[model samples]
Target: MGRDTSSAMVEHLDFFQSFDDVKVYYDNGQNIVKQALDRSVGKVLSKVVVRRRKTSMAGYRLEQVADYLSTIELALVKYEAKEDGETYNKFFGGIGSFKRNWLKQARCKRI
Candidate 1:
C-alpha cells in the first residue's frame, strides 16, 4: 500500500502557520514544505487515477486537479516574489498578526 502522503505533508508543515514563515523557510533553501505538498498532490492524483479506472469520478478528479493547480500557482507566485526581493507579506499578503494589522494594501497587486 502507498503511504498516505497527505498526512505526511500536513505533518511536514507542522511549524509554519502563515505564508511569511513558509516563505522564510523556503527562502532559506528549505523546500521540504512545498515539496511535501507536491508529493501529496501527486499521491492524490495517482489515487484519483486508480479510482477513475475503476469507476466514474470525473467530477471529483476535475475538482481535485483544479485545487492542485491553484495551489501550485500560488506556490510559484510566492517563490518568484521571494526571489524578486519582496517580503512574503508584500508579495502574498499572509495573515500573520503584523502583516494583517499593518500591511493591508488598499489595492491588491497582481501576482
Candidate 2:
C-alpha cells in the first residue's frame, strides 16, 4: 500500500487515502499471478497425464522406455546448446526477458 507499508507506516495515513491507483494495481497483479499459477498447474497436470499413459503393461512399458529415451535426448540437446555460445545466449536471453523485470535489479553478483 502507498500507506507506507514501511516500518514508520501509520504516519502515512494520507498515503493510504491515496491508494486508489495502487489498490487497482495490486488487484491486477494478483489476477496475473493467479492466471500464471493456473496455467502452470494445467501444464503440470497435462504432463502427468501424458506420462501416466506410458504405464508398465503391454506395449505401455515399451512406450515409457521410448519416452524416457527421448527425454534424455532432448536434455542432451539442451545441455549441448548451453555450451554453444550463440545458442546459449539466445536461449538464456529469451528466458531472462520472459521473467519479471523487477528481477533485473535483484540479480546476484558473483566474485
Candidate 3:
C-alpha cells in the first residue's frame, strides 16, 4: 500500500501536540515569538545562501533585510502586548486532557 502521509500526520498530531505543550511549551500561548524568530532566521539564512552563491541581494541590501526582520519582531511584540489571554483559555486545558476525556470510552488500544 502507498504511504498516506496525511493520515499518518494526523495520527501523529497528538505526539507533536503533547511535546509542544510539555517540552517546547510554545505552540499554545507563545506562537508570536516563534513566528518572529522564524522570519528573522529565514532572512539571515537567505542572506547566507545568496552570498555563498556569489550573487547580489537583487536590490535588497543586507540593511534592508535586517530592517524587515526588525519590523516583524516589533509587530509581534505589539500583538503580544495587545492580545487578550482568552485566545488560549481553552488550549490551556491541553491535548492530554482532551484525549483523556474523549478516549476514556474507546475499547481499542491502538485507536
TM-score of each: 0.23, 0.24, 0.22
Evaluate model 3: give its lDDT. 0.39
Identify the leading candidate in terms of lDDT.
1
How well does candidate 2 score on lDDT at residue 19?
46
Highest TM-score against the true fold, candidate: 2
Arranged by TM-score with the best first, the candidates are 2, 1, 3
How many residue pairs clash per model? 0, 0, 0
Per-residue lDDT of candidate 3, residues 1-111 (tens digit):
113433443467666445422211122236666555444433433324322223345544655555545544444444456542443325423334423542332323232
Candidate 2: segments with Cα more than 4 A from true spot: 1-59, 83-111
State the displacement of the C-alpha of residue 20, model 3, in Å, after optimal TM-score superposition: 47
Tens digits of per-residue lDDT, candidate 1, 24-102, equal 1112134666565445545643433322123344536755555545654554555556542346456554445323442
Question: Lowest-lDDT window of 10 residues in candidate 3?
Answer: 20-29
Q: Sort the candidates on lDDT, descending order.
A: 1, 3, 2
lDDT of 2 at 107: 34
